[model samples]
Target: MATFNVNDIRNDFPILSEKAYGKPLVYFDNAATSQKPKVVIDALVNYYMHDNANIHRGVHFLSQRASEAFDNVREKVRAFINASSEKEIIFVKGTTEAINLVAATYGRKNIGKGDEILISAMEHHSNIVPWQLLCEEKGAVLKVIPMNDKGELLLDKLNTLLTERTKLVSLVHVSNSLGTINPVKHIISLAHQKGIPVLIDGAQSTAHAPIDVQDLDADFFAFSGHKILGPTGVGCLYGKLPLLEEMPPYQGGGEMISSVTFEKTTYNEVPYKFEAGTPNIADVIALGTAIDYWNNLDRPGAVAWEEELLEYATSKISAIPGVRIIGTAEKKAGVLSFVIEGVNAMDAGMYLDTKGVAVRTGQHCTEPVMLRFGVPGTLRASFMFYNTKEEIDCLMENLGKAIQLLQPQTAL
Candidate 1:
């Protein structure tokens, strides 16, 4: 494992010191949501405490301060994703909202009858549902790229699926349920070859990996700030500027309009055109601090350490009797999901919780992937930079106990 100042990193998160069931909290549910660092929390508190004001329309000092803060976050997001310009980054609720915005605006605009939209089998429900809705509404066809048992997409089949009829290809940059890191670069290139645009659901991948949207040439990319240790209700959608300008506004409200005439209303530029109303201002401001926190870290080293944790956790848990490790993708982030034979995933999760080790149990918003694997769900132990090997050891110990308790019932 790469040596890191784990104690120092742990101190940045205040909640990590809390006790759950007399045991210190060991958060392993980072894929669902990460624990906030003190910096992000402080940023949020500071915004509401001092600079809270409605943005864009106000000429007052507080309003100008709030607007600058909010727009500064947009610049931070632009830099975080390496977008061509800040105008491309539209703040939304989260990845789901971003996808829905694209589907409603861009999908509705471009997709037509008999056109096809391709997505992978490993997409989260958020990615899947929006496109499905768009396809239904526009009379377009939804094509799925199949995956192997290893939870990796079949590239060979991807070629066959992409025909001249393909309008767009939306896929996850990383699988939330399986922890598979997809080859989005290749996928984007392939789609571009066919004159099809691509939207990458980057909700899971943004925190763990460095992203360069300009280099990737993706048409759209969406991610949640909360997934990367920022506050909830703050996320970004990065769309190519030309496409964003062409698409209509997602929601009509105060700030999105440039001029309101009784005859016809003029909309704002690319980003403000899509972002309507007062956004999650406090959370949006805090997201900039979250990006700062991530930038301060030794990212490659952190990811390397988390990869060690994944390998160690996988090796230790897989050794337990009747434990089946799922999503054994060669390239993955820090997710470790598995099923314990004869035990309900929820029961296992509950048992682990009693031991003060947090884990996510269920289809993890990817029921289609779960169904593809022929399982109800799996116990998922996802890691982050703050997670330690000792926590993984505790998880392994509790998992053994969980299996032992359920094994007798299975034998009966």
Candidate 2:
């Protein structure tokens, strides 16, 4: 087995040192949210402690410092995603807000009656609902790209779904419910071939994998900072420069306007045109620190380690007599969703919690995927780079006990 310096990584996260129910917290709920590193936390504290001021309008010392910090983070985000220009990156609350921003602005402008927007069967509610609302408002049609039993997108069907009238294709780069990593590069390429734009929901993939928006040729990409070890309420939307420049502003507020008159108003450039109001100034500054943390790590080595944990956990958990894994995609990240026969997913989650194991149980915000599989939901145990095979062992052992406890009751 390849060895990782788990102790050193654990030290970076302050919350990992604490006990959950008297046992050391084995955090498997990373798909939902990741714990903040000390660097990120300290950055947040330092921002408020020294440089708390509104940006872009003031020439005062604190405002200047605050504005510099906020603007610097934009450059950081631009580099992080390898966007062509910093102007293409717009700060929003999270992935949800980012998607809604595009739907309302880009969707409203481009989509009309008979226009189709394509989404995968495995999108989170955040990805799905925004487009649905757009379709409802614009009299546009929403088409779903179906997935196979293994939770992989049916690429063969993609051509049929994408026509000249297909205005947009929004897809998740990685499924939060399943670990399946979709071929977003191919998806983007296909959409571009049809002269259709693509929006990639990178909320799950951004944390586990490296991204290049230009390389993928994605029209729009959105991700949350919290999932990447930064604070919440600070996420980014990356749109192509031309597309961003063409779309109308998502909201009417301060900072998004270039000039305003009694009868006419002109919006700002790409990023500022989308970023309305004061924004999450402190969290945005801290997000740069989080990116720094990710940069410090051996990213490829970390991904390899995570893949090992996923494989080991899958093998161990799938061996249990009644356990059925929900997704068995060949190419996956650090998520493992499963259901044990004779145990309700909620009950299983509660049982694991009592044994000091943390797992998420529910639709995982992808109820359509759950309905397609004909299961209520799976107990989703997602891993991070800091997770260990030992932790997976403990989870597997506790899960077995949980199944044993429920089997007799369920049978009777």
Candidate 3:
């Protein structure tokens, strides 16, 4: 088997070489966001340099070119997740907006009072809050599936939770905080048997590895572009045709309309209907570049190298005294959440930062996860394909020093 080359692959990202605190930057916070590639960055610049114009309206050259680029990204995203058609893809601000869109449109339409919406304990706030709001507004009940100590969900509980009152089953594809890869295909199949639609929060999963909406047979799947190599303020929601067609428009404006006047206004078709207003023309166009970049790369090799980092880091970091690794699931990916016994997670985070290691600290938008583990928060070292084992060693070395400083002082 040909091994993935970490050094050569790192060169594609220019920001990786930058320094901080007089040390080379070791970004271990891929879950929050990933560094953009030259392709995506160049596309952003190229859009403004040439194809800068309002899309979908103007018949002029720049507008037509810009519109094609903007609309083409829908197809790119459609193919990216193996969605049935471009019509299934709706570009939103981020994962948060995508979730809210479904909750407002579909949940408001289908879910009703006394009905139940089931989620898991490991879900991020993006998944939880929207459902909570929908429940509150619709007078529905929000149910949670429990997880074991290893962060794996109790599938037995899920079967019980999928009751007659259950309107929808929404969960995370991968835990952002726990790094647990949920059995989404199995989960979806189980939900489908109950005739419950499933929505996957793919914000964390899409960037780390490959995903197929069809293979999972999910009713709706949401992901953030920023979590991958694409720009912030751009993300996608993939819903099955019937579900999207039935739901109301999320926001009403120019692009989303067919005809509008003082009287009743007609809306556009599926994807465009949910997508109102002018939209982020440039970033949406650039998103296709990010997709293209990921598609062009040796994806299997990239994923293999990421696993290598996870394995190497897990081995080294766990060996340290007072260092406890949370979420020891066998099927985890790209995240190493831990806490030093005596050290505050933020303290460890600040110390790690001084050493030029950028790792995320605290709840990571999954407060329920912290509560489940009975901790305040965790210091998370989330990896990416571009990260190196050498960086992992640096993190380990710095962590040892930080742990020592945080240790109780003894008589000298």
Candidate 4:
């Protein structure tokens, strides 16, 4: 395995060199999305310039090349997650669409009136809303797995939650707002005991750690390419082959159909059936390059160095009188969410912007978590493998300045 070298990795992403707010950019909103590396960018250019053609239909040279390149990504995704087959992998717009596809298809078919769907309090809006829509349509109830002050899931309550009527459990593998890495393998095991399927929203977890779906025994796993240094508008959903084959197609159109007659239309096979219409061909092809970029890097080394950065930042931020950390879980990923006393998160974010530090200031699409924490929102600083401890120092220095400027009297 390759060792973690921050300087060399940073050089691979050209955006790291650009200036924002008149200073060198210190991007910390990685949970929102990651910056693309040069290789992925070049892949995009290469596809458009050379292999510009529609896939799966044309028999011409460029079309065959494009189709080959596009379909090859599916195999990479299958291998990346250790999924049993490429047919189990379905391409969607991103994590949101992937979740919705399952909810609309498998969920609508499996869940019925008075049935239950279980989720956690820390889920992003994507995980919450899809099931809510499905429940509203099917007369099902949504059950929540509660959490404690540390933002960890209350696993003790899970036994009662997973009843016979419970149809499915969709939860986040990592809390985007809190940076809490949930014990998903344990959660999956517990759910399996009830013979209930669990779909892990791996949008936050995929970029931070190694994911082996077979080892986790995940029923369904979803993640986005953009979060893993790939292009936006392209993501993957990994399902157990049996489950995917059982679920109905999410959409209809070309490529997803095996036969079309005046009387009836026959849907295509498992993964292709779920994927309808002309897909995001170029972005899907570039995602393979993104996966290669991630595969070459030393993931374990990055995780360790990232934990060091988080600890260092947490210690320094805690020392500041007004700063309060939100998620204090023993296990966390590459996110640090906090609030400053007497300062609006947006104002603080804007203040940091002047110093060229990019951080997200919002509920992070996890409003229930915000309500639980008794904060309107938080200033979130999410790190990645390329982020450095020196950047944390810079953030702290600027955060102190922002807080002082926000409260002139307190500084005096």
TM-score of candidate 1 against the unseen true structure: 0.98
Better of 1 and 4 by TM-score: 4
What lDDT score belongs to each candidate, Candidate 1 first? 0.91, 0.91, 0.92, 0.93
Query: What value of lDDT does candidate 2 attain over all alpha carbons?
Result: 0.91
Which residue pairs collide in model 2, if any? none
Mind giving the per-residue lDDT tens digits that candidate 4 earns over 312-332?
Answer: 888999999889899999899
Best by lDDT: 4
Count of steric clashes across candidates, in order: 0, 0, 0, 0
For model 1, the superposed segments whose C-alpha errors exceed 4 Å read 1-4, 409-412
Indicate whether candidate 3 or candidate 4 has the larger lDDT: 4
Q: Put down candidate 2 lDDT per residue, 1-412, tens digits, no spaces.
A: 2345776788888888778899978889999999899999999999999999999999999999999998999999999999989998999999999999999999999999989999999999999899889888888999999999999999999889999889999999999999999999998998998899999999999999899999999999999999999999989999999999899989988899999998999988878888888889999999999998887887888888888889999888868898889988889997999987878999999998987889999999999999988899999999998888788989988888888788756434
Candidate 3 per-residue C-alpha lDDT over 1-412 given as tens digits, one digit per residue, 9 for 90 to 100: 2356778777878899999988999999999999998888999999999989998899999999999999889989999999999899999999999999999999999999999999999999889999999999989999999999999999999868999999999999989998999999999999999899999999999988899999999999999998899999999999999999999999988889999988889999988999888899889988899999888888999998898889999999879989889899989999999988878999989999999999999999989889889889999999999998889999999999998998776689
Off by over 4 Å in 4: 408-412
Q: Which should have the higher lDDT, number 2 or number 4? A: 4
Runs of candidate 3 exceeding 4 Å displacement: 1-3, 410-412
Q: Give the CA lDDT, 0 to 100, for residue 112 in model 4.
A: 98
Pairs that collide, model 3: none
